[model samples]
Target chain A: MVLQAAIEKWSGKIAEVTIGAANAAGVIKVGGQETLPFLFSEGKIPNAPRVAFEVWDVHPEDWPPELAAAWGENLKDPFAWAEACVNKYQAQALCLRLQGAHPDYGNRSAADEAKLAAGLAQKFGLPMIVIGCGDNELDNAMLPAVSEALNGRQCLIGSAAQDNYKTLTAACLADGHSIIAESPIDINIAKQLNILISDMGLPLERIVIDPTTGALGYGLEYAYSIMERARLAALSGDKTVASPFICFVGHEVWKTKEAKVSPEQGVIWEAMTAAALLQAGADILVMRHPAAIEKVKQHIENLMGK
Target chain B: MFIIGELINGMYSNIAAAIKEKDKAAIQKCALEQIKCGADALDINCGPASKQPVVDIQWLVEAVREVTDKTLCLDSSKPQVIESGLKAAGSGSIINSTTADPEKLGLLIPLAKKYNAGLIGLTISAKGIPQNRDQRLELAATIVSACADQDFSTENLYLDPIVMPVNVAQTQMRDILESIREFKIISEPSPKTVVGLSNVSQGTSARNLINRTFLTMAVAFGLDAAILDPLDKDLVDALITAELILNKNIYCDSYLEAYRRK
Candidate 1:
């Protein structure tokens, strides 16, 4: 009560923020809260988990062949590929995905993507997230299958949005899984989705908000500001917007040239890619390269301690 | 909706004297009243009371514990008082708070782990409450980092960004609201965001009316827990109604039932 009274006494006057740490296995602990984001002083924040590497179903022909070479033969099979990502790469969690299911991509069926999600979860022991390409219909159809397949494992379904929250949220509610509520780039819209989900009688703790991200050099700061603003609302007790957040790090990471292109064409950008994400308030980073994962994990780990 | 009773603290002279006299009946009465009225927890603030704050805290905690199984919200500025409260509580308590104080950051953190107690981290630095959102977040960041460093579970800490009065600055509520949202996004899955529901409506006409309005808005900002009087029908009614409007409770059934009883 003294802390609260003093904090309330000093609310707008203080100027320091804290970010928390990850565990040995990389699950970010809830402690070590302090004045700076993720620093170990202002308060207590505990375990910090490692990053979740993004894996796609449907061989990413769009991805450079060099990228495909990293996974070897596992790239061809979603289930095998996810297993390999976890076992070989020491990935803390897997973002087994249905990127190709988008109409513009593979245009796969909900059942098909759901089956992939089921297979991946069954085959991989790692905590996983099932991501769908931004197609409302396909996501609605497929997310439930993913939810049903994972059941009590507490998987995070790809998303629910203003366009298609009803179906996706229902699946998450039914399966005892969590859902990510994404908004294009507005704090108001982000808050609205959270309200919508709460309106549906789902637990706020079970949902993670993704204030949609933009690539670096392409309005990422706006996303950062929005995340910061949203967090402020949560701290102030806005139940709608206070849930934990999720960021599509790989999606934004890959879209940035610094991550996709090499140093010969430009300055060494891989380092920048990892650094940029850490700076952007990313909690669960979904990355691509083994090097980036290790780099980000290490950077995050360093921030966790003295 | 966690209601931490604000009574039995030195902020009120009668409460201070009762504890000094070791008036178990007086302290027990507050604790039981809160629990019977559905208080999830009771906040015992030992403000500027006894010279032996820690001893007083221990006695009050033990006294309250004897009377009710309801959890204690150990509130005190003195680290020793907090430590004594924790020691007295033994287990399952809520640290009234640890602030952005550098030395205090790591202080109550261990107590929380030791007692498995939930905590409240106020967003204020040694310089005191920030005047703006940036300053407030800075303090919040520091508090969250302290928790992270200690390997304290984020969920265990309730980060209160410190809501100031709307009369002094109308945007004060808005600023706190924004900070609550951002704190959650950044803190993510750690530190439950909360607020002192009474602060926002202070000095406003029809205080209860203002409090209810502010509570609804705060809930929209993603409020998970609030510290307020469970006895206030208007405040309680507002929470139930707000929950329904926000779709927290279905079809307003809970709201209607709550209203009927009131």
Candidate 2:
């Protein structure tokens, strides 16, 4: 008897979302696949997963030596760091985190954060994902200002949770930008937050799922499974959970001991985490470390057969 | 679930008046409201009062189609009335149904194929509504076989197990639910299952509560579609939550609002 491979067909396609405005130097489009990640023979995977270098508005106070060494003094200024990410590292996109606005950090005002975001966007027209400080109250106050300053640029802004999504969702809707819905590694919460954000009048096409990343050996499996399940649901014609995934690879990977061993080890660890997530259907990877970004980009190129 | 809004039927006084007076505004308003409330399709029926049943159905179909291109289920017992609506409905419509009787199947299945529309088969025949799950399954099998003999794909066929009014036939409610589950296995790729959801609560007090509860239960039993009042916010919410819990839809905090928006 002859055996043939059984092909699986899906009824739904992931909604394709474009980051950055029409005139931007590079507008990264993600999530127009009708099949599971990397199953090229099964269906179309229109866009290769994107790798974005993570930058912070404020200098790091508790950076591991290995991670900090990658940027050196450039980290002291947000512009220099962003310039390096664009010019030197050849970043496809930049993920700017306004960490200074955190009350525990520099406690910068909303105006200062908005100014930084507008300046960086002006300097480089790459697709941008502007993330607020982890503080929910502070973020609600700060992100709207940033969203206005980057109005019509179509930047992706967020970390809007279930409890506090109204402000950011409205901001994104007004500014014509996209949002990143954060869900704390729970699939239901991830979907629920997407619904809540969308209910506030932001279109689903303008929302991305941030299923809360977990680095290698640090609940990575849990994060991976959630993403896999969500992707499967999306492909199975569940429109409610069909947005592309944005995994904060740098944030989660850098915090792990496995990634803090050495600069080389940290680079490999971040790359490994990113590579794993790409297979599990991560459309946007917000990563740190140039070497890791390059490595994952190459891995994505290979997997996508480009 | 594929929710077919059941409000545009002329059985309602407002719709009956609209049909008699040829009020296009009333029909269009009903169509738009149902679509706004998250109806995947609208069931168009002239009810029983129309002297010109065929013309009334065509008018309803045209008026509803003018507002939105959402699928219209052309509903009538007479094949000519359904055919008149189907002619005006254009593509992607559904024939609201046929019985298991060979003659009804013979007429409607060909019409369904000619119009490239879905056909709903009620698992009841000239013998009347099935008494039990097994009888319903047997009729469903007969309909499935007849469709096969005519070379009509079962994928486009929706099998309804004839939901009876709980006040009148309370014992058959469980049987209907069971029949819905069993209908899938009658074929390899099963015909989709639907029900006239309001039938379960007909003439009962707390109709909304009973309708929603039963609709949720039917969904759990793999009911694929329903003909119900989408305007009932609570019932729609219950159906949304049930599908979410079953993992048929991804859950969100404002899932009720989200389902409507979708």
The best candidate by DockQ is 2
Compare the candidates by TM-score and give the number of the best one. Answer: 2
Give TM-scores of chain A for all candidates: 0.82, 0.98
DockQ of each: 0.04, 0.56
Per residue, candidate 2 scores C-alpha lDDT tens digits across B42-84 of 9999998999999989989888878999999999999999999
The fraction of reference interface contacts (C-alpha pairs within 8 A across chains A and B) present in each candidate is 0.00, 0.80
Structural similarity to truth (TM-score) of each candidate = 0.53, 0.92
Instruction: Name the runs in model 2 displaced over 4 angstroms.
Output: A2-9, A102-111, B203-210
Error of 2 at A193 (Å): 2.7
lDDT by residue for model 2 (A24-108), tens: 7889899999999999889999999999888999998788989888899999999999999988988889999999998777999
lDDT of 1 by residue, B123-182 (tens): 987887788889888888888888888988787889898877778777666788898888
Candidate 2 residue A266 C-alpha distance from true site, Å: 1.6
The global Cα lDDT (0 to 1) of model 2 is 0.91
Candidate 2 at residue B103, lDDT?
Answer: 99
State the DockQ, from 0 to 1, for candidate 1.
Answer: 0.04
Give residue A263's error in model 1 in angstroms: 6.3
